[model samples]
Target: MKNTTIALLGATGKAGRYILKHLINRGYTVKALLRKPDGLDFRHPKLVIVPGDVRDAETVSDWTAGCTAVVSALGQTPGEPLVSALAARHVINAMQQHNIKRYIFLSGLTVDVQGDHKSEANQAKSNWMRQHYPDVVNDKQQAYQLLSQSTLEWTMIRLPWIEQTEQRRNLAINLHDCPGDVISTADLAAFIAQELSSATYVHKAPFVASI
Candidate 1:
């Protein structure tokens, strides 16, 4: 919108790809960090791809420098070592060093906030993730703690199961209960992009879904 450059982590992932595309299409400059730069096919004048590991603090710091804001669509893969917690620390450190404030992190409905009052369905979903992906759950929990305690203007967007559809539709958003059960990946990206410049959810976590 304002020729602003935002640093994006996990730009190669399913949701991250959509976020990247949406940001670029909206005329925002994106500096994306990819573990494998060669795997990305899209090229744009406003896109700057950085090849590095998110787990590497120095690498993340270097890539995040000089950006107006940072957004993460990171998620843990099955059996892979958890990087979310470590990456959060590095990203927060870098943002502080560079005086970049706005941070929007994409999370699942499984992660809970202090005053959250989830419905039975959402509770069941959280239990399932905790049982099946314990490490990821733990890592994400720690990341939440770091974010909640940070001075940075941060918003953690908690989403339900993500479907790989390009359709953008009405999304129910709530500060306590999860609004719905599922949402399209495209719509999720749209919400993140729309919130990039808004303070409605600053320093808060909100759950969103298709109603």
Candidate 2:
């Protein structure tokens, strides 16, 4: 996927940072969209930092115009609802307007409304997430619903618990079941990078990471 211009939303967070590094190292032109694009000067030759919030439709639309694909690593913290949904809405609108069809979004495994036979631990965790972060999960579910119904070739990677570790190798990729107990951030980043070039999960919401 050399020369593919990827517009990455939330390009400064944990997973976003790893994705940026992998994209740069793999020689892909990156246009990083961030709410606060100050003080982050990776200074990589292949990186183009676009300083704007994803909530701004016009700004995101402009950035999406010339990009081959869009990757959203957007998330919601404890007390932020409007901001998170607004960003996701803007991303969807911009991609729609520009006719950019390939989108990969980072969502949680609990967003699965179907409740397919997941492990008991996963179910318990989902229950906990629903209790504590109900609004955030609901927002993500709304986002997933919108994306799933859209015409764009979108893939929502619903990941398990994410960890920051030095082990940076590709674990087994699965479509339905969780792959392992924990997923390293590096491995997740590598998976996203691989998906940029392949359609292993096109238009399919897959629960990822190692089981």
Q: Give the poorly placed runs of model 2, Cα more than 4 Å off.
A: 39-41, 113-115
Clashing pairs in 2: 179-210, 179-211, 180-210, 180-211, 181-210, 181-211
| Candidate 2 residue-wise lDDT, 139-190, digit = tens | 7888888887888888888887778764775576666667676778888888
Overall lDDT per candidate, in order of appearance = 0.90, 0.79
lDDT winner among the candidates? 1
Q: Report the C-alpha lDDT of model 1 over 1-211, residue by residue, as the tens digit.
A: 7669999988888888888999999889999999899878889999999999988889988898879999999878777788888989999999999999999999988888989999987899899989988888989999999999999999999988788788978988999988887878888888988899799999999998876
Model 1 root-mean-square deviation:
1.1
Give the C-alpha miss distance for residue 66 in model 1, angstroms. 1.5
